[model samples]
Target: MHPCLEQADILELIFKEIYYRPTGSHTEKDLLALALTCQRFKEPALDTLWDTQLTFGPLIKTLGISDAEKESENDAFDRDVRVILTNDSYEPSPEALRRFSSYARRIRRISHVPDARSSILEEMNTELAVLVKLSSWVRSETPGPMFPNLQHLGFIGTLSWTSIPCLIILLESKITTFSMYWGNLDPKESEVLIGLLGRLGLSIEFLELTPLSYIRTPIDPNKPSIFSEMPFPITLSWIIPLLKELRSLSCGSISLNQLALQNLASRCTFYKLQSANTSDDLLEAISDPTADILSPFATLQHLELFEDNFRDFIKLVDYMQPLALQTLILHHTAPPTASTLADLLHSFSEGQHIASLRQFSIKHTVSEFETINSVNMDIVFDGLTLSPLLSFPNLLIVEIDTPCGFDLRDADIRAMAKAWPQLRRLQLGSKIGWGLPPSVTLVGISELLIHCPRLEDFVVPFGARTDPPPITNSTPIKKNMTYLYVGNGRAPGDGSEQMALARFLKHVFPDLCGVGGEWMYEYGLEEEQLDWAAVISLIKTQC
Candidate 1:
């Protein structure tokens, strides 16, 4: 009797520990083993065992079935579990179907009874009967809400068109997020599902659709059609009105026709539209007036445009100005003419457009340095003044990278530092034909310390073959410097120039906390071997 009492106490401790463990740590099999251990362990272990999110396909295949024996077995399994069959490749054995149906029915019973709070069934690719069975169980057996805490649902592969209307009816009021991939739903069927969500006044915050390869081809361009006239299996137009409550949206690569873009933009506030290996037809769609219906992205704070072919920045500038945006990023190489730069800057600077601009980034792609070498660096420096007009008096970050041709001059550096007195972070990169003059290098660093007294980060990449000149300033180094990055190539005079740079940094910028080493290849040193830590430490100690 004393030994029995001790065993009961040990069992109680194990039960308490299991109850406090986080939900995702254990699998159903593990919990089942614990349940079989003793009567004391059975009840608590069963509780954790049944509260599960189960996926059925991989589990079924893992048990094994021959290809030739699958069809009858699958049919038998479908009847018992109510799984609707869609794809031709899958065929489960009768015994395997029986096992699946038993387990699914058990899960349903456990979820619907008085105690369970949350459950999930994901990636269902089964037949219609199985879905109907599950939905009917939820509707009839569950007491208050079918799935009171059900928050996520995912579908992969196709479902029979007939099964969708029933599935939509069951899911309309419960799920908050739904995702489907590689599935085909005919327009009429899709409309029915949309109508169900509309009738329920459901609020779905996220929606994603990934089209199968066969479904991605555009309808014959030679024919005239409305979106409804297209022969494709899916039309998002029917669901657009219900999508107004969404805060985030991601759609797989699809050709955007004017009607589709207009409908989507009108519904969603934050949007990302991406197309890879684009065609001429899509480009034409963007240039058309209908595209503007989505324009200025009035409530959009972040925007990314890819695979674009507009000749100039004028269109984007005109379209985006009214949004009063905060962040802008432009990719792909565009010819940077002085007029083009001035005009682009003027658009953002004038009026109330982008008055809240805090971060701006422009990335150019060009192999030969000569293409970018043609632009006058002075004009580029002057163009930066355009920011103050937008009330960005304290521009915090700027990144400028262009291929080759322009060199930094002393006057260019002075004008930029003077123009944005409160600038705190700056990154500049120049390709082949561009190198900063020694005077420009010294004055630029000097002017940065003077005008932007609060500056904490600096990255300057010099692609020239000349040595940087010494700083002529008599003022002491400021203690505010915290991070620095410098990438320099081999200069003509070699070690002497490197030594000069080391001394200037050590004496002039004594408080430097971090440094990115110069990469000078000719000194028998690998690019990565440059002693950045040593330099920064030395500067901090000296200051």
Candidate 2:
């Protein structure tokens, strides 16, 4: 006989690990198999199985609706739909309904993509698209929410209107996180959405909104920008006040109502906030120090800005004097010269922003970073070295990408290591384009292992001129390094100096596998899609 399996927590963890794999045929099959196993694995297995639901169609299918056959029929409405998502006139099998309830409540997150490929409400037709309203119309309905315990909700639909009712139905008290991407919606529909969010009140912690396109056509901006033409019909004031306690917010691709946003920024308490990458309006508002706008980001600990230009960055940070900010993320931007860098550091230090900030990140554009090009450190690097940054008591992470126009090199690297010796994860350079010539060489990078003994991840550019200074270290400098990526493109494409550089890394950072910079762009991948950590492992095994 099999030994009695009493470790329920261990069983749950095992199921969770299995479900972490890519969501495909294998994951579904494995989860189904575990659920069908002994009753001990039922709850945890099911919870893991339903953690990230791509569609609610499966739950409807569990009601025994022959979805395939129904789709084949020409009729827009499916007969089996009423059997489960019924109105006043219909009834469902108690056993089937109970089974549906069991799984629905188990779901903690749901991505209800009920489009043509996974249509549930579409089967009910447009009139019944608002399931809650339809249930009221019929005078009879299910006893519980469609997702009673669902804390996170993400909806993907062809049109903005398609997800509005779906969002409304699931915008219950239990849901704290909501993300949606839809195509279109009218002003009336937009109003309904704003009303629905009020229901969530203080319970909502994370809200992501993406509009497929602007509800109103934007006039040529040669003259003026006005709120009446704002893409979203709903005012930001109405939405932000509702989620006053929001800790994290991502307003995706939606140009917010400026007036409403101004009011919200002045009053709302956001710890971490990110705006879309489309425009500079929001960024402009954040740093605007006009008396009309009180910097509402008084409690913000993290602020992320996605910039496509270089000059705007100077403006964006110039006015952002935060009180509690710790982590700042700047993505996809051009590099700054040593003088410009000094000016920025001085601004933060003089403003007292660096006093509380522990992390400063300037994600530089590819190949354009320049540091060695400067003739004097006293003039260029002085402000950087002498600024408040060197004194940041709590500073732990200093990551800067290769500057867009600056030729970053050895001296710059050494200056950074000397300033922030407490850094544990020090990464510099990018995987793709930066116009400036590479300047960082082995001479400076070697100092990192010597100074920052706790450094765990070191990524730097082995530019065309980079070469390891003569070193015969018998052992690793600081064995704590967990990840390393050196831009080993300095040697000719025929692979001459790469071997020596590889050897240098192998000796210095014992855990390093190989250099990486070309593979990602060659295959066309975004930062999120590329798994550099896994690539490190693969390169290590190959080496």
Candidate 3:
């Protein structure tokens, strides 16, 4: 290749890397600037700039089509074959309208018809008419052959359920991923849209619905109660039918009534279900009578049930009779009981022929302080029958987010070590409070590190109150421990506490890879001194 071309190629590659960085990375702005330095850089940079997903109002403003012309044709088309109009709200500006109109004229899909009378302004108006005409054309178009390569189509702002029917009629055959947020469609209307989706011949692999909120009271408190009480409509229940074809489905605050879930299970072989707020009513809806609610997930690989009713979780486990479940996630909630927790584990072992379960995460809600403090350390560590099951011998990760005060004994840790020989990651939450003895904190952690020999990552809140006895080298630690996270809290021995902890780590495990912690403001160490670099370096080594 010529040297000039090679130089251009290098610049293009650099530009692509910078453009793809996560939104807030420090290098993003600088990279964008470098890409605009010359013509070769300009083309790729502009391509990246236009690669953005476009919204409807912005398109209208960008194209500069007049409202009169838009009203006349009712069809809008774009020359960029890859471009898709997102129905998100965008306030249009005059310049945007002209740009879009100019781009629209080059596309073959928009046909121009001449009238006997010709005027420049009228010709511009006619061009606008063509754009609007395209929009209407899309509405009436049948589903057989439009947009064959389209992967995603998102609806942004409020749109009536009826409008969605048009969408279904147009692109249903080609689109595989669909997402909608905060639309005006009521539950009944939403159901209609879902039903329409079920009839589409194409397979939709992913579906996401934004949370819907209805106003119960007007802001004017003094106005005569204008809001007449109508029997609140039954919760919207439309998506059940379409669930059958979905590989993935996510919704906000879904009410899993029995019928809805049964419908979902019968029709859809869903591999994943993510929900924000799940009620017992909904849990009861989907649970199998004889198995854990999770049991029916024969094909399910990933499940995220965030901070739901604990009872529902129990019911879920009861229904989730052993299947091929691999990953289980429980966020912002405490385990209901040792028995319940055991049952969940047992279900995974007995119900499913799982070769290896990858992750088990439980993040306790902040309010569960007492529960965390009161956790029966023995049951969690030693009392439970986890060892005999030996079901998750290949388990890779376990995470628990809870308040401080719960204490784990050395024997309990040893039991876990015996059960999960190949465990790789463990994340636990710790809060410092007045009630617990300092010795209890240090010993529990020391015991855990000593037990899990293959463990690689350990995250715990740091800075527990200073007690007379500091963590010593009595217990042996696993040499492979590589990542450590210490949360912010009070630490003993001033700034030296961190160094002391590091010393303890080095002494107990000479192969110590990383050290980092959250120290209380009172500790007087600047935030910059938190040893994050050391921690990162350690993690890199382990990886």
Which candidate leads in TM-score?
Answer: 2
lDDT of 1 by residue, 103-136 (tens): 3332321111111111222333343334444444
Tens-place lDDT digits, model 3, residues 407-483: 43435455666666677876654432212332234555665566666777766443333432354555665666554
Candidate 3 shows a clash count of 48
Cα deviation at 257, candidate 2, in Å, is 4.2
Estimated TM-score per prediction?
A: 0.46, 0.60, 0.50
Model 1 error, position 377 (Å) = 12
Rank by lDDT (best first): 2, 3, 1
Model 2, 63-175: lDDT tens digits are 55454443643232354454445555555466756766666677788766544632645533332253444333222335646667888877665334554555555675377
lDDT of 2: 0.54
Q: Distance (Å) between predicted and true CA of 503, model 3?
A: 7.0
Cα deviation of 186, candidate 3, in Å: 9.1
- Candidate 1, superposed: residue stretches over 4 Å from native: 1-242, 248-257, 267-296, 307-312, 319-321, 365-394, 410-425, 430-439, 449-457, 462-484, 487-500, 503-543
Residue 536, candidate 2: C-alpha displacement in angstroms: 12
RMSD of each: 13.5, 10.7, 14.0
